[model samples]
Target: MPKKSLLMIGVFLLATTIWAALPRVSNPSPDYQTQPTNDGSHVEKIRAVWPGPNPEDRVRARVVMSGEDIIFEDGPTSQVMNTHSIRKSLLSLIYGIAIDQGLIDLEATLQELGIDENIPLTNQEKSATVRNLLMYRSGIYLPAAGEHDSQITDRPAREEHEPGEYFFANNFDANALGTIFIQETGYELGPFMEEFLATPLGLQDFDANNVIMGDPWFWPSQDTRHLQYYVYMSARDLARIGAMVAQDGQWGGRKVIPKDWIELITAPHSDLEESHVPNHLYSHFGFQWWFQEETGTVWANGYGEHFLMVDPTHDLVLVERNFSGNSLLSTARWLSSGNKFSGSLWELIDTHAMLVKISDS
Candidate 1:
């Protein structure tokens, strides 16, 4: 054989050997699964800090990437935990679908939707529209259905700012959005989510049993408009949701959500630093997703450090959850206060830097 041909054959053999040495990932769900590689170095930094010194940081967490890569996971990734505000992001996806189908209108005012309460709303509050709620700019502070007392206590006064003029991470927005979905579709959130999202995404562990509905006692009004609900899901399932968003609503080659709607929701609408958010690495809020300005990534965040982030630039989905199920009150208090915990601030900054480094590496 010619010398050049022999050299080319040797190169091919070497490449094949290297490829064969790489690990393979299995996927029982529609999301792609790829084996962890040197790409997990950044994730290792996260794992090293897991169950950190603080009581608050000593919690469960799981991380996954696009292609369903098990980047870094600790504790039980399959354990269903209260998603808290992370539920809002899932709710946002439902809203996008509802709007795309013309089942709900973003411009529909609370009054037009017949979303009234036993306690009369100020005209400004009444003027709040679905769009305002999605933006967290409703400025309407009527007690939320599923919110705990701590959340309610933290809320601003009713109609504290004109509609479209303020941003507060109030549960009322999500609950009200839930009400709109039911009123318009004649289907409850659990069933609807299971059918449209969970089922389609091939979620491994989601069911009606995991659903937490609005507590009548916690609500400000008897009206269903004040009703709210939340879903508890596993980290892997949340990562699937993140992957779907990262892919612009496409999952397994299917258009699960409209691209335009995804763009609209992920686009920055409110600046959180301007809103006086403390220790906030991310500065902007999209529809329900939070935008990390530094990384150009968007995430669904919850109390207790539950997060599912999507970096479209790298086609990556990362998730971490601190299961507050065992210590709800303590966790809630810590999260609501926005205080630093277990070197989280430093770890978060380091993780972001590491991801960038790894991606560039």
Candidate 2:
């Protein structure tokens, strides 16, 4: 065989092996229910409120669905974008499944799970249970991958609070939960997500290959023991997950996530008034989800203003995404433009107002 031909054959073999290793759903569910056509009035109502001034240029995609009908959708809802910290919420969903199957014990301490970091966790810190991490009350203050400067600055001092005594939105807890999930389940986050969550929910644009784990752009040289689990998902697909959560984890007449687990995750576990979270709209903290007690809303929030909001009160699911780009250079460029989408609870409120107005009319 010619040298060039041999090289091409070797490359082909490698690619085939890699492709074969990727996870696939043995039987993917049917596509999610969407309205045959978008309601024009609903579209106009949502559009009038969205991209409101600041978020206009940065809002990349959005999907608003009520029950089984997609009321409004805009931008490339199918385009995959880095979901930032929303990966934590996805991990929470997976945890619910794992816990139900006896793969993980919520009350198990970090010491019991053999969870540690490069800097080493104190014996007291190791006493924090898996449940504590889920509630962002782990009280482990070590630097974590994907944390913003504000989080680092505001992080409680070592031993400032005992396990489960305080609630600080620390990425360390979120990232460590990812590590625990992989350890307990013997499956990577991506494949587990595909087999357990995405397949069950019939997500339209989920690709296990796109799910990655690494340091955040600003914290590239951080600890390697527990990296951030970054998921790339489309707004439309996220809406499906939100809808499932809204319905108490049932999808297509099948119970995907346990109803009790869903309730536990969305129910407030942290002190509402004492938590150090920057957002006033987040009235309480659930397992890994954010809660607005007044409106009965649960949401998964990510950096760059990405949100997956499930408002069971109104039977509404809204997903918003701001493309931070895929590569470091592209992400840097996007950040340099000074157009990152902002607001968390306020954005949800604005969107919900539109829904309310449309409903009244």
Candidate 3:
């Protein structure tokens, strides 16, 4: 091609890309309002803070909520970040939708699918159920052999649990699906999710480019953009999700997820502490979604420190974007310390809300 032609083509593509990147000026759900709907000018931003003793380890993050901007030199609001295991939250939502659509039967046993303890699970491990898998209560333990077969299973980003616990993580990815098949399972997790969940939810952004465009467009080596891969989401997108879930899987009354099914999934299935939540809060977990006791609040958390909290009772959604993979354990140790990572993020919101309420009064 001639140099002039190439240059014109490049400029045209750049302009198209920039135009496509702009947020759509469409109406939000009538049930929910954008924080700064018009003007788009006073949008709040939060900053990520080190929040620890390690000065170099601190990451400044920006936070954006219902329309208010809270910027922390220490934190951030709109910067897109990976949603580690929080991806599981979205996964469960997708799975629930599939089941609601009659595409999957939660009660179905793996044995019925010819998934008997074969290559993947031994005789002792075949008792797992799809519900059990979603609940992280499966019988299969992290495969031994020292993660030698790590990239062989359909594990999530990272799961911290005991042996015989249906646990898996995206880290190191010993459970990479290519190596391990979903034997002794009712339905193949990957193909099923790709067809039912990813295809339904707006996550087409993640899978579409890869599936349609090979190699350079999609990283064939890692398939890193896969759903199991930490998803990159924006604050507004996350809020939209929160709003969707709040409406019981209905987007503008279109029945995105079966209404009855959404209620079933959000309802308390097990105590959260039993699943590793805190005692002070009546944190409970169901399927993949988590719940709070008095707060009736639930949240989805991602690694590298991200939280998407929804308080339906208050019609409030709070999002905190941070990086906590390095200091995860440290946050646990210094949780009592000022601004330790754990749930301090919530306290920050409560503090702000209280101030707002007082101002209103």
Clashes of each: 2, 0, 49
Write model 2 residue lDDT over 1-361, tens digit each, in one string. Answer: 9999999999999886665444322222235423223545577767777754354576477888887568888888877788888988988998999999999999999999999999989999999999999998888998887788668888889999999889888889998998888889998988888788877776777766667767434345575598787788878888888888888888877999999999999997775688666667778889989898877788898878888888876778888787777655556667887666543446657888778666567
Q: Each model's TM-score? A: 0.76, 0.85, 0.56
* Superposition error at 198 for model 1 (Å): 1.1
> What shift in Å separates residue 1 of candidate 2 from its native position after superposition?
40
Q: Considering TM-score, which of the candidate structures 2 and 3 is the better prediction for this target?
A: 2
Please state the error at residue 229 of candidate 1 in Å.
1.2
Ranking, lDDT, top scorer first? 2, 1, 3
**Quality of model 1 by C-alpha lDDT:** 0.71
- Report the C-alpha displacement of residue 326, candidate 2, in angstroms: 1.8
Candidate 1 accuracy as TM-score: 0.76
Q: Which candidate number maximizes TM-score?
A: 2
Q: What lDDT does the true structure give each of the candidates?
A: 0.71, 0.80, 0.46
| Candidate 2: residue 64 lDDT (0-100) | 88
**Candidate 1, superposed: residue stretches over 4 Å from native:** 1-58, 146-160, 215-225, 326-349
